[model samples]
Target: MGPPERTILGSKASVRRPKERLEREERPRRKITVLPTGRQFAVVRMDPLAMVSHLDLDSVAIEEASAIKPKKYLVYLDAPQDLPLPQSQWCRFWVQPVATTLRPAVPEEGITSDMVLPIHPNTQYAKGRRLMNCTPQFPFPHCYLWIRSMMSLRVRTKRGVDVYDNDKAMTVSIDSHVAFMSAWNEDSRRMFALRRAALSSLSGQTPSSEGKLRKSPSPEVVQPNAEHSPSFATLSIPPPLRIYRDGSASSDDEDTSQASDDAESPHAPTLPPIPPLMALAIDTDVFGWAADPKVPFVPLVDLWFELEDHLSPDNIPSPVELWREQETIGA
Candidate 1:
């Protein structure tokens, strides 16, 4: 029969399939639903530097402004009455107590009328009674609202600015910390989540070499607390002069010795006593939205306020004090 029935030892049926094809077949397919054109959201572009320029002031002026007690006001988000309930919730959720300081435009002191305006004249609805510096009582909610609402929400401070007329109310956008949070897309959020998971997994695992390296080092040679030695007073003494037998060169020897000493111990480098690091335990669960997977974005409002409190005039250290602190740290 056709060449002894063609008894093929290695047939195509015996060959193994490619790993990539098998993996692709075994992999779970992700369902991607096409969103309607109306459902698609767009990120509003903002020029942070341009916005900051509107609120620019000299350091001395800023210091003076900080001294003045900020006037409190209840800012209201004027959303359309016919708007859907979910969309209108921003009026309550985002709108909160805000503080504003009166910064009147003085034309005489090189401060023109335009300098006092809340925003640049080119911006829409950029009218304000005067240039009033505004900050939200709760920065996160306000920033979230501003970002989500396409930066269209205005700061209508009628009571704070002593203006009863709704038409003339100080209508300006919150531009101070707008750059803190961004409207991240789904892909960005997914990538961030993956990276965070990878980092967390790596943190729990100990490398194989770690234990060996730890045991290899001698205990006496490697002091764990060597950097944290007790504080001692350092004395600044000139290098001892070498008196050579030849009369031609005691001064040169002294100079050379002093140069070498200076090079070896310039500033007589001293390690400062490092204070024990006290962990500040914070209850993050208080922020309900932070851990919520449904809430795609979380504003960095928590960090902003904490930093603001520390950087406040009362808590802030002077330049001289900072210099002294740096010297103590040997920085």
Candidate 2:
């Protein structure tokens, strides 16, 4: 048989090329917004008297006495939430009253007192659990509570029980300013009446005593500066509120230019002038660490008496309404 003709091969141009794997289109990663860091249950307010009343004490009379101090101001702290499971297993809570000073205390000098309350691990961070009772009364107007967590070694020794603490704690500052203000406002009328009665009684004292009292130092009077005296017109007239879009005061030139523009466009709608911004004052010193440097103190909680209506939404004025009120007052 004749040799089979060799099969003819197609030209390379006509031959199909192997398909390359399709490149995957990479998806754009989602942008994550980080939230501000805060504690789960750092500080919350509770009725100090009610907390003391509920304590299981051996003597009911002692509990009653503690709960019913006439002149004493009490602050009670309770665990608002549970601690992490790991921490709850081994951590024990403790609180100590530390002295507060105008200047930070030197750790080497020692500021913590001997009055430390050790709390059980099971109820250390339990929700609604009473932790400590704090009294703002001290030599200083303000004081700090040193709250710490210590790990129990679970070992008992004859000499003493050994405990491990990383020296980490949170310090909460308690001040009598708010309490004083509230008391003062409540008794102001009675205080004035008592002062008047005392002044009348002072006339009955002996002449020798009166002489000594008269010789005591009198406060220096402050006289107003005559050179920088404000005139009646200046006192009666309020400054014009010329706020710009960027919260800056408009310059005289800018005001004049705006007036001219307004005059040129006689039918232009008039926009109300912006009022001065109201500033909200917040006291930040309510949270601070003790002067001791040995412990790494975190200022995580602030305990203070705040009025219920202090920052209520209903009390806040809308921007437009505020501007209108200012205009009316100025007129």
Candidate 3:
């Protein structure tokens, strides 16, 4: 009862306050070092609902949003398994068709008799043949446009468009006009083919940005002497992955040879004849680290898919396939 029983007002607070408990429990964990070479790996937690908020953070570097473009995808008949097509014939066939017609998206007025394909290429009995080229005579008549038209029709028709697993697919829906445009241009057709081939390969491999551009052999050609030139594809790319199994086989053979030379060898009696060497190779490429810490990079496949969605409709992948193999690749 002495000194008026000291009343401690602030000490009356609860030991475990709700706010303190939440602050302690919900705090984000500190980032940890990653493997191979242990270095701190930064963590970025972005909520879909709060994307803008995260994007606006002072620490984040904002890039100018690129205008989204659609990818171009063109469909043509696949080469028949039995029929081996000569390169020259394939090139020649693209230029002319017996009954193939051309209706330009923007047919120029100066178009004379020389400007039209005259008639569509007669592909009636041509097994495994498809018309993909536009007549050169037509002013600005693009083959891609025609192909896009055809693609659009097919995509909308009863026979649903069925693209192969490795086909080059864009994000945008392949509309009628785009398909027609793609059909009218040889360059576009080649691009489509190259992309398809690369996509097929990349579907099984790890997706990377630089790899995609370098994926297809460069279209560039360089003159050797005065007259002839060679495509970049002909130029040797130092083989990325060494045929290790081949080396192993060679080593085994060398070992066998050495053993034969030595008279004293145990268990040398018919060592299963080396199992008739079946060759295998691990395909690999060297990835260089960036020297500068400031620059950010994006993968080529991602860029390609992004482009496919906006500018060109032909490159977009089919929805069903996109959903199925999305986890497996650049899709």
Residues 1-331, candidate 1, lDDT per residue (tens digit)? 2222223456533333466467889997532211111111111111212222224335653444334332212222323211223222221123221212212222112221122112222232223232222222222111111111111211111223332232222333444323212322332354434434444444553343233322221111111112321122211111112221224368978999998797688677666755444212123333222222212111101101132333332332211221122122111
Ten residues in a row with the worst lDDT in model 2? 149-158
**Number of backbone clashes in candidate 2:** 0
The parts of candidate 3 lying over 4 Å away from their true place are 1-129, 132-267, 271-307, 310-331
Compute each candidate's TM-score over C-alphas.
0.16, 0.17, 0.18
lDDT of each: 0.26, 0.26, 0.25
Descending-TM-score candidate ranking: 3, 2, 1
- RMSD after CA superposition, every candidate: 31.1, 28.8, 24.3
Each model's total of backbone clashes: 0, 0, 57
Off by over 4 Å in 2: 1-181, 190-250, 253-257, 260-264, 267-331
- Candidate 3: tens digits of C-alpha lDDT, residues 111-222: 1111222112333222233332321212111222122211000010011242122213211223422443343355344445555555556565533442544434432222
The lDDT-based order of candidates, best leading, equals 1, 2, 3
The stretch of ten residues in a row with the least summed lDDT in candidate 1 is 296-305
